[model samples]
Target: MKFLSAAALAAGLCLGLGATQAQAAQKALLIGAGEYPYLPPKAQLSGPANDVRAMTQFLEGYWGFSKSDIRILVDGDASKQKILNAIQSWLPGATQPGDRVIIYYSGHGSQIPDTSGDEEDGKDETFVPTDFGRNGDQASDMLSDDEIGRALNMLKGREVILIADSCHSGTINRDIVPGLAKDGIDARPRYLPFSGSSTFFADARDVEPLAREVDTHLNLSAALPHQLAWETNGSGIFTQTLIQGLSSGQADQNGNGRITTAELLNFMRPKTEAWCQGVEQCRELQFTPNVSPRNEAFVLQPVRPAEPVQTVTGDSSEDVSDVLPERERDKIAVRILPGAMHEIGDEVQFQLTSELDGYLTLLDLTAEGKLVLLFPTDEDRAAGKTGKIRANSTLTVPDPSYGFSFVAEAPAGNGKLLAIVTQDRVDLEDLLAANGTFEPIDDKMGFIKEISGRLNTVWTGDTTNRSVSWAAGYKEYEIRP
Candidate 1:
């Protein structure tokens, strides 16, 4: 695996800082090294190496870091001193008072004795180097989380991000002994007074004998399994989801153009361990975001509707006869009064509106199942932004300030138009709870008595018990024809 040094990062940040203070630099040290060739062959180390390479490409290509601005270090037999030295050297001076820094590690991680004797659990979370040792005397080889934390804290900045793609092994390992080599054990150890053999915290080994130290590491130990889980594909499950969220723009729930460190962590931590049911097995990814808080809650609008998957069996040439434009026209000007329905869309204008920040995509329900953009051609799209329609600001209420439009010639016949919004559905009840109004309408554009199954209705506006009337506020609207 390869790791990027901080010096290269500093150079890039220095250039980008310009008038801005050199306080925070977007820096990352990607380390992917499995104890290969030397240690017994573990899960093929191929997964992590590929993942690290892909990460490097993302950082430099999409993230816009000059190749020279990043450092890459891989250790097959690299020593702990060597790894620490490189970390200290990578992104030299990458942190400033309020600056942000990111550290990504993809390899084997473990919890070891907190030789400092300050931890109540007697165990400190540690990241294994290519040359980790099982010997109690090999102090120089172990990399403790606190040690790294202190080193990172040395920076002028307080906010630091550390991603460990390794799972914590609680010391309850009945299979493998810590001082002695052993593996495989289930069940939490009994909580007891600290033993001389115990390193940091009293229950440090209570979780397991050699279980990944995810439980007690980085102040996340209080949360148990939510703290440390397994890291597959060289990236922890949470880390993988985090990267996807960044790309999907889900981390930016507020629809902001950029993703801050805090955004990534907030979106990833829970999603990472949601699968674990028991407290004993649940793991968490901890973020020590010091200095300024990072709001990664930016919204990402979709570029186009997600295309549907189709399995083609035979020849590509099939239908061409049904492609005829409608001859008879029943035109109706569809308009929602200002603040009436927030947003609207159909064959002509597939506009989408959402209280939560997400993308709007239009899948052609015209039987072709084609994915297309839902918005009209009038709006301007920002970088990393997708979705057919979106709000101008998250702080803004359901006051209909944002909308989009689209137009397409429909085929002749009684074809139904279907579309979906790419965001979490909001509760209409809550919107109504805040004094939202909903009224049923009759053909005469007057209030109706009741609504059900299907209405022989025509032109129902804002004041209708019609299904369209429920689209008052705080929810994404889907238009069907």
Candidate 2:
């Protein structure tokens, strides 16, 4: 669902600008008010405070922003006027024209009437500050999209990125009514319970077009219109994944040692989806996080350990996501054990785990680059064979009931085993009936492309054929003569 827009193109252009404007000062204003003072007790959140704290650490240690360059507002300090001042007055005054700016919000989000008439849906998205409704009317406290856009216009020509971790962000359409207050409705993956209400006001500031250098734009949001951003262990999953990509270098898809904005989206979308489906609190209702267009891409080649790899080809520690550009999820995991060497005729073992209930697809690669279907064989179809893999359960491959074992064969060299987790079963009767492995892949990198693009039909949830969610993962092995 990632499409391109003018803002995305401008953001991409900002990445190219980095090579020349190396001196641009990096600045950030992180806002998250977990304790909405005026709202009832059930409205409080535990994630936003943790989100701002986590981002402060990342911006300072990983992205190299000085502690002084970063500003934070959490709980009692994050009033509506203070947040506006921080962005509109404080940020513009402190930063130069070309400074690299980052603005993040992680908290409860609601909607108000679109008094400006720009919205076809009659609702404008808004982020709740700690002091919502404190200044006479709630609309004055709510931060609308246009208001934020107008604030970004003051940046003149700064390269800006906004990470909005909230609900109703994709295209806010839900209306709030007075009702029973709920706990973590936004954080629990449920639709707004009609208790979080706010009315529209006509005082919204008009917004000008974004500066040519990308003053205000975001390529994606933490969740979509109906989907809510959930938190675990006091941290928003969206921000946690963002930090993981930045610190772990796992989002570097092309393996050129550079993690582009496009690459990061490709990495985050599936992982967030998988996490939502995996967690018991969020599984009932959730959808893929909405993605916007960035025709131009910015590079995030953060310095990490010396583990570099191209798409699909990697070390023993690397998995399928290292090579595949799309379809990486956190719900399911596949690991190759001991990462040791073996001789011909030796059986290979694997450990596959899923945090939620799902189907399993196992594929194999010989040292010769030939591909084979290791599961759902013409052999085992019942007894949960090729059936639902229990959540929180581990499946050890090469079991006697599976009929066939993974006995290593000739062409003694290094090989790989891939384990894919899908929400539904993929019927591979064509390959299973072949009674053997497919011909050696003409191109090693093209192997995954072939599986996802051509050979495999059920691994994705696109409109064409696949209607289920899936994740890509693998493990490496070796065979000696």
Candidate 3:
């Protein structure tokens, strides 16, 4: 009797050990919007709504998450408070350390003035519900990014992932024509019917602190404020690109059949750029980490990938100029296009500083005056490390505190570099201008776009160089040295 009991107990213990091995960390929050009575007809197809639904399916089916493990909120009905409640409820309790949490949003996203200092622009990111006030009169309706970030911080887990499909300030744009209002009978056609009980007018102001800003054509449906601009992006851009990266095997760069954060960024960057070339557009697509996990063992092994082969070129003597901050116009230091030009792969450096914590952004203009290079803030360099950012033929020093310089690497002929230090960071701007002036590399701005595309078009986490994607406006080039 003792022998039989011992054998039975041993078998049960073996099964328990096997069950523990199969467990993994996985949770998701999905949101979308489609139904809107006003403005651009609410995307009758509701791209964002469909997009989030598909994402939910992929996570539950292929990512090993159970249906019940995912939480979904959709449409204008997916209000700020409701979304917050869902997020709070999804927090894991007493789970093992490696578990991961994912949050996804697909809908109109806008920015509201954040009087609080938590955000850089003092603007908080919010989701535009069908009922969101296109005119900024209703105070209680809008949500802020800081508010959402606070909720995310409240969760006990350190591995929280944030996937925002919302527009940030001037990044996304839908233009409204001025004369659309006075064009006779059909000229003032209201896109959506609004109860004229309130004079709804959109706050007509340029988005703050962005390198490029666009005016949008937004309304409750399409008619309020007689064609004013709003700070929101349609949902389709985030949805389509995210799906392409995850589903088409493009994101699985290592042939491992699983996705990583790096792969996702790599795959989505170019795909999004392609989607919004000219028509309603999103300028800067940002990927931020909500929580950084520490010392957690991942089921998927981390792999160190090979670096790019440095294309060598002979060093030429670079001209050094004092880059002085002209206090005449808003204390901004603007780049003056040099008269002479040289070949590609030339290096130039800038010595810069900053009094306040503001971004040091660089823009590489295309021949058509379209923006090609966008290396903003910390995204330009890994944290704590500072160096050069190659924008086609130009190099920029994009740091806040100390003076620094950059050497040009990725080759292109010539392009102009525009640097903007906020009105607040006047001291740093003055320091940089007094220290350096940029060197000229090429003649025309045509290839500048191509060169900028090549340098900035890096997929963050992929081991494979061939599979790495391009920047927001992916351009194909054929520049001969």
Candidate 4:
């Protein structure tokens, strides 16, 4: 029955902003379960409770939520029945039309066999309750995304936000050493049935239907579907950045004295990535916040108007030939055709043609900020097929037979593709080694840095005969339901 202490709640309640005209109440149900009494001791965490506590304070102080309107559930108190009652009965019943409802859960997340067969991935993402059991029957106790979606369907509120700072996968051993005694503690949430498999897939379609019911439904997840969400000290990194972004008004990107759902995500995505890189344990761990907003954009908070600034502009066209040493301008020409937005499921054929004969490399930066090497895959490398394009020749990516094409995924955003043409063959063994043999690098900045370093080492000091050039194209699209 351990909850946020009365004194702590009082402190959160006492902090408030200037009152406005009477409006619909803003209610929040903050659930943080760090202790699993029914599970192993190694599965216990110390960050969830703190996460809820911090969010509670932020909601009360800046978001205009009264102490009475916010419900805090922590650790042992977040049992299956209590959680279901709060979401199903308490939240939906308490809120009227136009009210803003926020449901934040900071805990372990797992997956179970999809008995309903609705999931294409054959699994269902679930939230691990405090009473989660190790027995096979524990699936009944775990809360599935469908159940939450059903509860959300009953809510009368127009603005509903779901923030989950937990990963839906199982244990991951991040130990760097080999053959060392390892603790069974997983940085992620506990898995049911104690199965060794940690593979889990979270599809946006599972909740997209219920989300469309509301006027504005914003779902902010700490990590991508199959990625791990890391915690340090006593709080999740995403929650920490969220609190800071709201409190400091750093998320107000437009400087319009308000923070929108989209603005908050744009502000937090890079900050979370940068912060994760600094953490020793989270360096290799990719933390990409998935922001899915249904319908129209909604304002998250109001801030003081930003100070006005002066405008400055440089010459529209400046010749870089004078600044370059004649070898840096352009020796190889590259082009990507059909540069425009595309449908989610459409097969995107990217055609690259080079004016000079050289090796080609294709890299993609997904909307979620994931860096993937599209060309010269491991298989291609094993086959000794150098990514060479003959002079004035065209190279179609994926070969159509390899079943390779760019298909947009859910939570749509912008994606960029880069084509690098090098006079000499480029070896990726060093890059692969640096990335721990992972195809796509986990950290964006790390990827950029590694690629830049490799390019420098390849093209620098002796470019009299070898010339390297790169061209990039981007696509902005929507993922239709």
What TM-score do all the candidates reach, one by one?
0.43, 0.52, 0.42, 0.51
Off by over 4 Å in 4: 1-22, 134-137, 169-216, 279-281, 294-296, 302-481
Regions of candidate 3 where Cα sits further than 4 Å from its true position: 1-22, 37-45, 92-98, 134-136, 171-235, 256-258, 278-481
lDDT of 2 at 338: 37
Q: Could you tell me the lDDT of residue 189 within candidate 4?
A: 29
Error of 2 at 306 (Å): 16
**Candidate 3, residues 336-368: lDDT per residue as tens digits?**
222123223333333333322344444443323
All candidates: CA RMSD (Å) = 19.6, 18.0, 22.1, 22.9
Q: Candidate 4's residue-wise lDDT over 1-481, tens digit each?
A: 0000001111111111011112345678999988888765667777899899899878767665668888988988888789889987888778754456788989877766667777666666778888877454457788877777677766633356788887754333422111112253233322223243454333433332222222225677787654567666677878999889878988887675557667788888898788656544555545677766432244564211122211211211111112222232344433333444544455555667665567776665444435666676665665566677886777886565655555544544434455666655545556644443224566654554444434322122231211124322222223332
TM-score of 1: 0.43
Query: For residues 127-223, what per-residue lDDT tens digits would candidate 2 score against the true structure?
Result: 7777875654456568777787677767754556677677653322243322222344334331122223454232322221111112353434676
Instruction: Give candidate 1 misplaced runs (Cα > 4 Å).
Output: 1-25, 36-38, 43-46, 93-100, 134-139, 169-228, 233-235, 256-481
Candidate order by lDDT, decreasing, is 2, 4, 3, 1
**Whole-model Cα lDDT per candidate?**
0.35, 0.57, 0.37, 0.56
lDDT of 2: 0.57
Candidate 2: worst-modelled 10 consecutive residues by lDDT? 1-10
Query: Considering lDDT, which of the candidate structures 2 and 3 is the better prediction for this target?
Result: 2
Q: Mind giving the per-residue lDDT tens digits that candidate 1 earns over 1-481?
A: 0000011111221122111212224555667665444344432243345446666776665554546545555556345666566556554555333333445565655555667776556666566666654343254455676667555535422233455555454533322221111243221211111122434332333332222321111121112322344443243444456557766777775453445445655666567445333233332333221111112221111111123211222111111101101110111111222322221222232223444344332212222222122221123232223332343332211123444223223322112221223233222222122221111111211111011101111112322111111111111222223
